[model samples]
Target: MPGREARPAVEAQLLLASCKGGGPMQKRFLFFLALLLIVSLGLLAACGQPTPEVIKETVVVKETVVVEKKPVKLVMSFVPSGDTQQIITGGEAIERLLEEKTGYEIDTNVATSYAAVVEAMGAGNADIGWLNTFGYILAHEKYGVEVILATVRFGRPYYTGQIIVRADSGIKTLEDLKGKTMCWVDPLSTSGYVIPRVMLQAAGIDPDKDFAKTVEAGSHNNVVIAVYNGDCDAGATYVDARRTVEKDLPDVMEKVAVIAESPQIPNDTVSVRKDLPPEVVETIKKALLEIAQTEEGKEALKQVYEIEDLVEVDDSFYDGFRATLDAAGVNIEELAK
Candidate 1:
């Protein structure tokens, strides 16, 4: 009985040890299963959530730039009709006035001859011209130069050419000019050469052969001075050109006498190049018209060409003069050639 009891006790002891070992194994299994469950739940939650969207911010920088502009420059040319120095001074005054009126830079030039001014306009070297009547006509025919204004003198729109001689020279008629030295302003001069030549021809005197000597004095003032100084026996010029030298020679009016006077000739013109911008042409025309009404403008004009005022006119204004030239057998194209 003792041996049986002892066997039973040993068996019980082994069973107790088995139970204690089994308890630790069961706890480890439960802990591993719970960790796997937690990992699976976190993955499921991550799969249910939306993907994050990245936002980008952009910044723009602005820069400012500036450019400078230059003013427009216009060249105005003139024919030397009187004292070159006086004409230059007057031209500069006009330049200043126009610059103030138009806000454009103005440059002034006095050409050596009328044709030079016309050619400068045609060549685009000049934008404006103060042209004599015949010079304007020639420029219009050749380069389509346009006349915007005609000069007024003593309230008259027309002037006459006079053939001058010393008061005691006894050259009373155009016939007396034959076999005498003759002075002319220029071949292109309207009153100084063209009309006077026509007068000589009408008198049945040949200008080419009748004169003992011919001189081109280059300007109206020079022609008057030449006649007064006895360098020329007779000369042609604009009516009363002697007054130009009256200050220097007080006896100029007394010494120089008018032998004959031509018919009415249209006054000189303020003309522009053909290719000039229409707006610019209008501005120039308006400025000149306004300037003529000013006292300062009047004095400057007097110094330039003895201009009394400026009157607006068109090409038709010269038609009468053209007809006269045609009737006299004077061919403008031929003269141009």
Candidate 2:
């Protein structure tokens, strides 16, 4: 093997070239084999070193990962308010305001049904909503929606549910409503169905059974119009619902009368999906608060819900709604049906 040393070098070069080109699998396999051989040789060599004294302390290594923030994009929905386009036009203003103020991308939807809005939140299609108090509770209970803020109608943060009758209708009191056609708004409507039902039941009238017939008018305004036109003997709606139609039905005040009013209920809620970042919730609430401070903003708020201010409301504020539902024997889950 005097001049044969070059044969071993040539063999090594040929073996490396065989594994290197046009064959990733082969190359990787060879790499692992070589790594295993090197590890085995290293272990053999390490046996010659004297054993080191064991240290009593354990060392922990921490790793930090930096993730870039993604752009905040969301959709907002509201239960339909008779004028779907008006809600859109008004909601669009809030979208624009939010985009400008918080750098978020927002899309607006005026949901056809209150339950649809709740579904939107649960399905992750909607990140925020302008929900009536009962709608919020249903969404919160069923879908984990988190309350961000509440609306102030006109100037107060609370309003009453009123059962109104035509001004000239022979019906002067709740008793007169018995065996008469009654109009109710959506089932999800707090002021439209739940509160007025409670009022009727308190007066010894069963809305489901006593009324000659009951029909849904869809929205508060429709409930008012139904009574104004004598289409129904009586209808339930939020207080001052007649005022909302006076401009169109100029005799709205003269034609409609509030026969009974429910106790003051908490105002509608400005809610976000529970999974939303707290900062995003704060940003949205802040932008809405700022929206109520200017003339232009005031007009936008008015178009949405005649809102004058947005105030922070915690879960405790909505506890009364729960009590009312329980006391009336209304099942929150059944309403979803």
Best by lDDT: 1
CA RMSD, predictions in order? 12.2, 18.5
Model 2 poorest 10 in a row by lDDT: 1-10
lDDT of 2 by residue, 41-128 (tens): 4565566578999989988999999999888898999888556677788889888888998999898889888778888898888999
The best candidate in terms of TM-score = 1
Q: Please provide, for model 1 over 1-337, each residue's C-alpha lDDT reduced to its tens digit, 9 standing for 90 to 100.
A: 3464355345544544455465787756655655565565556556667899898989798887877777878999999888999999999999999999999899999999988999999899999999999999999988899999999998998999999999999889899888999999988899999999999999999999999999999999999999999999999999889998899999999999998999999999999999998999999999999998999999999999999999999999999999999999999887666
Q: Which runs in model 1 stand beyond 4 Å of their true positions? A: 1-70
Task: For each of the candidates, give the backbone clash count.
Answer: 0, 0
After superposition, which runs of candidate 2 have C-alpha atoms over 4 Å from their true positions? Answer: 1-69, 333-337
Cα lDDT computed for each candidate against the true fold: 0.90, 0.84
Q: What lDDT score goes with residue 132 in model 2?
A: 90
TM-scores, in order shown?
0.81, 0.77
